[model samples]
Target: MTATPTPSRPVWRTALLGSVAFVALLWVLEVVDQTTGSALDAEVFANGITPRDTDGLVGILLAPLLHGGFGHLAGNTVPLLVLGFLLLLSGVPRALAVTAVVWLTAGAGVWLVGAPGVHLGASVLVFGWLAFLLVRGVFARNLGQVALGLVLLVVYGGVLWGVLPGDPGVSWEGHLFGALGGIGAAAVLARPR
Candidate 1:
């Protein structure tokens, strides 16, 4: 009798491919944004979640894929790849759902309480993945996850400071809310006992 392929084989393949594709999309968008002399910036930033602006609601969907500059995009690429890969290791469906929750939660929170201005970047997702990685193991009670979280904490813990207000023109609101969203996603999606 032929043995069935282990489910983990497919899960890993999907995680790798999806993570690459998502990061590739971020690069492509940034290339276009750069090529246009940042004309795309005005359009994207203008549409970005503006507190109390009903018309800017769509920023919740677009903001995660948009960045203000190549420098901004460059900074987010590695964390997005690493944490994103780890998140998707759980399975694409769950990962995507978590991303959607984080995206909307961060955007909405920014809209509700963020300072008045245009906020834009992939940092929201970066922060989301960071927080998710930091807490998912606890929520799921998986030793491997716990170990992975510890490793990530060592490597990326510094970024967590972004959650606090600092640096003019930086969107601490996005970081704070994205982290909160990650916590919420972890709680909601935890493995049932």
Candidate 2:
């Protein structure tokens, strides 16, 4: 018997599916943590980037995936969805590369200079995407992208306050560094005229 051929997927659809899958993964991890009485959180905290702690450096790679609780994750959900979807719409491979740059920059920045504590959450990535979306157009010299950036700025500008060291428990460093990483990514990835 001959097998039916699978249809090619559209780029937008693929990006949408990837974003949905990522959010689903985050929810699943949160559910597991909640169900296990936060046992998973312990692992997260243990692995979380602790400034000056050599061993905790590994958490740099894992921190974005671990959240303090569902409430924490909830705060990050919309931003992640919006920013991630926009990034992926540009192209999945490029988006992924941009994410990796932001991830490493945010994580390393936190590890190097963050306050003493376990820094965990996708907020880091969210902030990075925000920065990227806000500045990428200027570097690329694209009027459309510039317009998109302005719109994003008007909508999400308030969150920029996150970079300030205000909350005792919040990782403002991550926000600041994630933003820097985003700018960096845009600069590195911008199309030459």
Whole-model Cα lDDT of every candidate shown, in order = 0.85, 0.88
In candidate 2, how many Å is residue 125 off? Answer: 0.5
What is the model-wide C-alpha lDDT for candidate 2? 0.88
Question: What tens-digit string does per-residue lDDT give for candidate 1 at 4-120?
Answer: 976556777788888889989989988987897766665654557777788678777777778877788889988888888889988878898999989999999998899888788
lDDT of 2 by residue, 73-179 (tens): 99999889888888998898889989999999999999999998888899999999999989999899988889999999999999999999998889999999999
Pairs in clash, predicted candidate 2: none
Which residue pairs in model 1 clash with each other? none
Q: Best by lDDT, which number?
A: 2
Q: Provide the clash count, candidate 2.
A: 0
lDDT of 2 at 115: 91
